[model samples]
Target: MNHASAFDMDAFRPHDHGRCRRAARAAAERECQARGLRLTPARAFVLDALLESHRAMTAYELLDRLREAGLGKQPPIVYRALDFLVANGFAHRVERLGAFVGCVHGADDHRAAFLVCRSCRQVAEAVLEAPPAALTAQAEATGFAVERVTVEAEGLCERCRADA
Candidate 1:
């Protein structure tokens, strides 16, 4: 599947969560094997937890899930898994909220932009081909080499706006 073009928001809501989780796990496994990376038990479990929900989750929230699953009841366990996932491009950290969200776009390196729903904490991610021209130009003018960029926009989602 073309990860970038295949993304559909409707598929993420109130559907077969089990299938979604499985597909994500399978994708990760395949990608890891292709890249010679080890997807340890803890890493897999944490990835599964994030994939199970489209909503972004804090590290503490992920720790609770790890505890429930008998993975390990320590903060370092979750952090390590998170670090590995983020470093490998399997996950992205929402700097605005200090939380993590799985990369639904498979495990490829791409610029990420997020539409964050503040009220419900739902996060939708899109893979960007390049940094915004404005940002690029500004960086060039300042002689700053831009490596990676994360653009996040925060607002209430449709449901939240309607509720208000």
Candidate 2:
């Protein structure tokens, strides 16, 4: 499911986040139902936390939230939920930051590119229609099949630039 090829810059600007969060939640519910996956309370809570902001959150931060919400105090609790969310494509792990964020575009397994704000740590997701030609060629030369690709570009966002 290819969406608009344009880069998604919603995280850098102010918008109706309530609508975004609601839509993402609804999408997750529908996906889970279709896939026969159980969206347990703890998993739902973790998804909600990740969707609360575009900022990536570390597992420890999520664990803190879970503990405060009286969900579970153990590290494994959060890890398990994260594993489910990621495996089901409802969330993504930002490897550069060692954190997680909700799938703003829903769960289509689309190739993803991220624009990360170095100052505020906000991340904007974009759809990468295809891998770079050079990379593909290089991989072909080496007889390596490309399975997945995630691009992360770091820079200051509009607000951060203005402040600077």
* Cα lDDT of model 1 by residue, 64-157, tens digit: 9989988899999999999999998888899888899888777777767777878777787777677788888899999999987778778877
Give me the overall lDDT of model 2. Answer: 0.88
- On the 0 to 100 scale, the lDDT of residue 52 in model 2 is 97
| lDDT scores in order | 0.81, 0.88
TM-score of each prediction: 0.87, 0.93
Return the top candidate by TM-score. 2
| TM-score of candidate 2 to 2 decimals | 0.93
Off by over 4 Å in 2: 1-4
